[model samples]
Target: MEPTDDFYSAYDDPTGAPTSMTTMSCAIENAKHMHTLLASLLLGRKKDQLVRCDIDASGLYFTAHSKGKSLQIKTSMVSDLFETFQYFEAEATSFRICVNHILDGLGVFGTSAMASTAVTCSYSAQEGVFSMVLTDDGVLAECSIKTMVDDEHNDCSLGVFERSFEGAKVLGHMILASNALHDACSEFHELPTGAAVELVLHPTSFASSSDDAMCFRMQAHTPTSSCEMELHKDSTAIVQVQVEATIAASFQWTLLQAGLQVLPVASESFLRLNAQGFCSIQHMLLLGSHRAFVDVLLCPDAA
Candidate 1:
């Protein structure tokens, strides 16, 4: 079962002594912008599903686990997004809270307003509550949602994916505008179950093929006004397909479709794959004053 933020206030200890606490507070001038970007991270059926959020001097990080935690998508809200940023912790501080609660709290300030809503978000470890104060047009609203304690046994780690990616043999790496890739993937989105979407990389062109017995393939060549394709084996540099060897990998069609979610907000994207067909898509989303990186790793379909 997934974790969720509670609606009730945290129960105090029987001793009545306030326990050790960790607090992080920040003020933002544009709540709507933050709310919009954050809403994109919610996916599960539970409207109040918990998401791991980290706040630090550098930025705010949010991560959502999907596919039984095998897949993770993370986004960042840099300090530039805040009008006043103040965080204190012995180490990186992380909390799990319901994303919907945060959205609802921020959404109180309707978009029709001429100016952005001023928001102050604070959380205390001892209280286990995420509090938000929103002021719009001189009206103030305060919201408090209880946070979830971490479950060590249920926590997921990215070490497996990281290690696999680090050791996989790079077959090809390509770069393209987010829209361009999304447009291409749309053609293969309807491939029947068990069918695989194949990507063939040429030195100067790229093609996405689907094995539907129709032999349908959508090809894009480099030097096009919007799309750029590179294929190489040297992972250290921008990879380009070798002239002597053309590389191809087949991934589940549905997995590639997930990349489309990033297109609406991202400016550009990068695609990389290994000989074993494992693939990763990285996109940089454009927030108002800051930017975020969203990466999705998809396992390949069996040959």
Candidate 2:
């Protein structure tokens, strides 16, 4: 279905000010599209969850830290994803908002057969309100959500496509089809809580037959037993693989699985890791003619 076009106009700003000074001002008419795409970013229970939203001329970056878990996720909704996106400030601005509130106030129902729901979002520093105006056909609904300070401490490098954070030298990396990787992780669904999953990479032997030359594998330990799956370098599921040295690291099962939320919709899965056990799994999502990305980073505690 063709997405509706309901761009936010200047008059929609609750501050009554022009877009020049607004920290974040954007609109998208595909309410259902936004809802499904963003819902994949939720880490845990949505209520009271905080997500750092960074807005620049290009688009929005949403970074969320998993509570008590050393994992960081950064997802982007580029300008192409929006109908009308504007960054009025001279420099980029960042703010923390309740993801639950933003998702709940989207007003996505009753939009399938009728006019699509157009969502206009902006932050007014004057009243300290993140205003959202939902418009569909002749209907309009306004919502105001509180903004908070973004005080995150973790770091990641997938945004730059370099080594893992903290200067860890990349030890192994692989690019593969998202659906294939998603199927490989299916065992995680059965692992009990607090389980640690291991990413293993090595050939069955230094020089083996094509059928036995596996290079990518994932192993999981449940409460009672363990399960593992291996992928050959020439496997149809693998797009590319580069592993000179052995790579075997265990990480918190929960932290690793969080990134899988986007796998179903992603076109490709990029995995890179360093000796420090810091790993990055990037999900490449296709958006219309453009593309967006969701990067998940696992930190020390997850090791």
Candidate 3:
């Protein structure tokens, strides 16, 4: 049957934005030709069965419903289905002439461009399904269509190739390092003595079957060679560091000995050191008498 103006009216409604009218018309004409062919193929078997056809820009979808049974046709392949239908439409032919034209078109059985480009096509006679997958120039295209006798379901699937590199390991490492540096700077306080300090954390080591912890060792070195100290952590939960400094002979010894005394220190100054080699000099104290001090080193070790 020719595509009437009513068929085109289905897409004219403003509510549904169906833009490709030319493609839709071609699909409708193809479906009509398929309907006629199917009728002739089943002529001797049943005369009461009614085959209906519908088409759009995407492709053709046809359904034959009769005697509590249905069969569907889906045109997913980019083939002569469109061209043959256009030929018949231009000829202004009857259903019989259109059916003959369709058969003649099918006789050629020209291969698709995808097929010529190393694509493989397969058909399942029992399932009445066709599939094509092509790979060329590092690009892939695939299409699948299925039609069943006495079944209302018909579907098509198409896909194109693209490159994807998600969940890469390098990205994970960068994110982890950024978070660690941010937390160290924001949460740790600065020391009174002007010495460059940073965290030197060690990887977690397994001490026992049930217990595991990290170790840290902090070191602070100043311009003068007079003062140098090291701090250590004896256990995973506590921060214990030893202070040893060498001061100039001219400076009073009392200044170098002041920080050695047992004084109440705040929690912010007392950072938890868990792993070996984990260091932070943010808590070192400066004494009034300790001038010409070499460096103050704080180192923590897992006990």
Candidate 4:
């Protein structure tokens, strides 16, 4: 069974105590935008899949980790992204919610009907329950979901993410059209599950002796098949490439496909790898005039 907490342990910050999910709720005026955002957060169709949502004054943050925690994806919808936001607590509060339920309760899963929908989301810490109300064209629907707490989850280290945040200073940084990644992976269909995708970042001079400082290439291979592709300055698929030093690493193809699938509605993507070979990709999402972002982090595959 998953870990569940009681209100008995939830303390107020006044006397210097840690806070849980209390007084955290909001009204999402743009339910359509939120539906798309949660669609990106959905890993698989499994009904039991969970995501950790952190609520603060800034906005609501959804963080999900893979089965083995080898991959992590974080998406943020700022306060302005929602129609109305409210959090009475002085400290941040978070709880695990079944993403599938919220997505299904949305009612406008894949249609314009979502445009007419308004979502009211709130948490009941005392009862350890999360609830949502969907009002679409006066037809109201309500959903109640249980919450979970895992004390060890919040302790994961974020040191590796720092390198990706450092911008051009990282070992390799590539700004590519997200569509290109999807297309590239499609071309590697023969590389079955568990196959590895090799990414190489090098100075263009090393290959073409051109003025372009950096070049990015990928190789998808398995025991029976192999394929190679390169994104050049001449291609519209690539926007920018900067590399202080050439680096090459292999990452599980399946692990990356998960992140790539999240950006079907996005255009640009930022990919970076640090000296330690950890990968972070920021997929820029344009949700209804407002710009939201999804960040995916991956651990390098053993060579």
* Candidate 3: segments with Cα more than 4 A from true spot: 1-24, 27-44, 70-80, 84-303
User: Which runs of model 4 end up more than 4 angstroms from their true locations?
Assistant: 2-22, 108-112, 153-169, 204-208, 211-214
TM-score winner among the candidates?
A: 4
lDDT of 4 at 210: 68
Q: lDDT per residue, candidate 4, 84-143, as tens digits? A: 777777788777777776776675333677877777777766666776666665556666
Say which candidate scores most in lDDT: 4
User: What's the residue-level lDDT of 216 in candidate 4?
Assistant: 81
Better of 3 and 4 by TM-score: 4
Q: What is the TM-score of each candidate against the true structure?
A: 0.71, 0.82, 0.17, 0.83
lDDT order of candidates, best first? Answer: 4, 2, 1, 3
Candidates' lDDT values, in order? Answer: 0.61, 0.70, 0.25, 0.71
Mind giving the per-residue lDDT tens digits that candidate 2 earns over 1-303? 111122333344344234644677788776765665566668856466677777788988887777764777777788888888877777877767777666676743453622277777788665556877777776666767867655555323225323345487677788889988888778767887688888876633445446547788788767697978888877877887776578677887777777677887889988876777778888887765667788887764444
Clashes of 2: 0
Global CA lDDT computed for model 2: 0.70
Report the error of model 1 at residue 92, Å. Answer: 1.8
lDDT of 1 by residue, 1-303 (tens): 443443323223222222255377777887876775676566645676667787777878887665554355666777777776666676777777778888877776565651368777777877877777777776777777887776535556535665666676776566656665566455444455445556665443324322211111333222322222332333222322222235566655444555447676677777777766567778877666576677766666565
What residue runs in model 1 are displaced by over 4 Å at the alpha carbon? 1-22, 110-115, 187-196, 203-255
All candidates in order of TM-score, best leading: 4, 2, 1, 3
Root-mean-square deviation of each candidate, in angstroms? 8.7, 6.1, 32.5, 6.7
- lDDT of model 2 at residue 177? 96
